[model samples]
Target: MVLIVLGFIIFIAINVVVKNNPVAAKFAGAGRILALVFILLGISTACVKQIDAGEIGVKSLFGSIQNDIMGSGLHFINPLLDVKKLDVKTQNYTMSGVNDEGNKAGDDAIKVLTSDGLEVTIDLTVLYRVVGADAPRLLRETGEDYRDKIVRPITRTKIRDNAVYYQAVDLFGSKRDEFQQRIYKSIEDDF
Candidate 1:
């Protein structure tokens, strides 16, 4: 803003001087040009943003979302509609529980079933992280509820789908590994 004011002053001074001294006015004109250039460059620079590493930004122009994603480093943006950043980084989760066995559980849960059809409660802990790059779409589509809707449903589906394929014996015996792998595959597909 100051630069804009200075540029206007220089331009007026140049025009005034031009009325009497032509040579001095020519030098003043140069100053005016430089000042105006400075003002424009300053405005443009002010509109730019510098996103840090591991950050992603969604840019919108006049309420229209831009398809291109902005990432780490400096970028020039329009003052009218600019960047909104979202951090994308690996995170950690921890869970613990106590079992009837009188032992501290190592973040694991167990769901059981009987010969008759019934829902069994299982104690389990999951330490998971996002290992993909579809976070923007994920967030946009599900907002903050992505975990509950996408993650938990997929997890439950995986468990149900795999569990149905085997009898109760398989869940606790040698077939457990196969059941777990199947569950993992199912979850992966959903994810």
Candidate 2:
């Protein structure tokens, strides 16, 4: 955009200013050429988008999100459109009791109350990925930082919601797999 603006300024100056100055009049054509170069360069840069492997692009124009997406490759698009690249590969998120082991600082483990009225600390690791076809809707509704706005909160809530179905000791021992499976189903449905 700046380049295009600068190019227009130079073009106007050459036509209006150079015509009056006989000494610099010889360079009028050269100035117009330079301006054209800048404009073309600006247009090319803005129209071409390159998406890397395992990534998708969501486009928005004038603050309105577009439904159609851009796959991994070069795409020619509107110069005014804004493109946000998102990774589509499997992503890992952890909420652990140990510092520096989770996505956030400090102990980010989930605390859930069991049916027996016991408080349990859970270190959770979730593996997930963005659906390429749903990237546009995801961006439109949740913006780019969906992990903080959607994933983390929803995951913790589902875990806590299902934890009450079992006793605290069972969650860590005999019924651990059942507890995990229940939460997994809950989270999957929500997502």
Candidate 3:
């Protein structure tokens, strides 16, 4: 938009200058060419969008979201529309003491009280991805920061809720898988 305005300004200035001075006529032609270049460049750039591999593009016009989910590669879209890229690859959200590849390590491990009234710190690593087909719905419902807005809060809440159903010793030792499965089910239901 700025480019188009700048081009229009240059064209107006050139027209004014050429009428006053014949010597400036040659420079006016060059100025007109430069303005055309700016306008063309802006239009061409605005007409296309690129979605990276393992990502989905969500389109929006003004503030209203469109339902179409664009796959990886170059896509021709409305110049005025906005495209938001969302990573669809599996991401690891970790609550751990050490940082590792593919893991979003953080100090905020989940703490929950067991049936026995004992408190336990649960170090969890959740691997999840947004379904490409559901990308539009995800954007409409949760916006762009769905990981922070939906995933993290829901995962933490479900884990803490399920933890109270089991004994602390069972959660720490023998029945770990069962507890994990319950947490998984709870989180999956939300999606």
Candidate 4:
């Protein structure tokens, strides 16, 4: 947008100077050429989008979403549209009380009420990624910060919902795997 405005200003100056002086006429032509170059550069740069590896591009034109998901590489798109990049790489989020490297800490740990009316604190790690094909839909529904808005909320909710089905002791002992699997299934279904 800046480039387009700069080019227009230069074009106007070129026209104003062309009729005033013969000596400045040559410079005016050069100014016109420079303006054209700037405009072309702006348009060309905007039209070509580069999506990095393990990422997808979600294209939107005038706030309306386009269905196509751009894969990793350079793609030609409408110059006026906006392309938002979403990482498709598998991400690991740890929910824990102790702040470990690459893990989220503090009160983010899951707390749930068990069937026996006991409260339990569970630390969990979620390994997941955004589906490349669903990037467009995800962007349309959740915007750019889908991980915080969707992934965290859904995972936390599902864990709490499934936790109440088992005894607190079972959740920490023999039925651990079953509890984990149930939570996983519920979260997976939402995605």
What do the candidate models score in CA lDDT, each in turn?
Answer: 0.62, 0.93, 0.86, 0.85
lDDT of 2: 0.93
**Highest-lDDT candidate:** 2
- Higher-lDDT candidate of 1 and 2: 2
Q: Which residue pairs show collisions in model 1? A: 108-124, 109-123, 109-124, 110-122, 110-123
Q: Name the top TM-score candidate.
A: 2
Off by over 4 Å in 2: 13-22
1 against 3, candidate with superior lDDT: 3
Model 4, residue pairs in steric clash? none
TM-score of each: 0.51, 0.90, 0.87, 0.84
User: Tens digit of lDDT per residue, candidate 2, span 1-191?
Assistant: 88888899999999888878889999999999999999999888899999999999989999898999999999999999999999999998999999999999999999999999999999999988999999989988999999998889989999999999999889989999999899899999988
lDDT, candidate 4, 1-191, per-residue tens: 67877888888888888877778887986899999988888888888899999988888899988898889999998889899888889998778766553355456688889999998987778889988888788878888887688778898899999988999889989999999899889999997
Cα RMSD (angstroms) for every candidate in the order listed: 9.4, 1.9, 2.6, 2.6
Task: Give the per-residue Cα lDDT of candidate 4 at 45.
Answer: 84
Worst 10-residue lDDT window, candidate 4: 98-107
Q: Candidate 4 — what's its lDDT?
A: 0.85
For candidate 3, the 10 contiguous residues with the lowest summed lDDT are 97-106
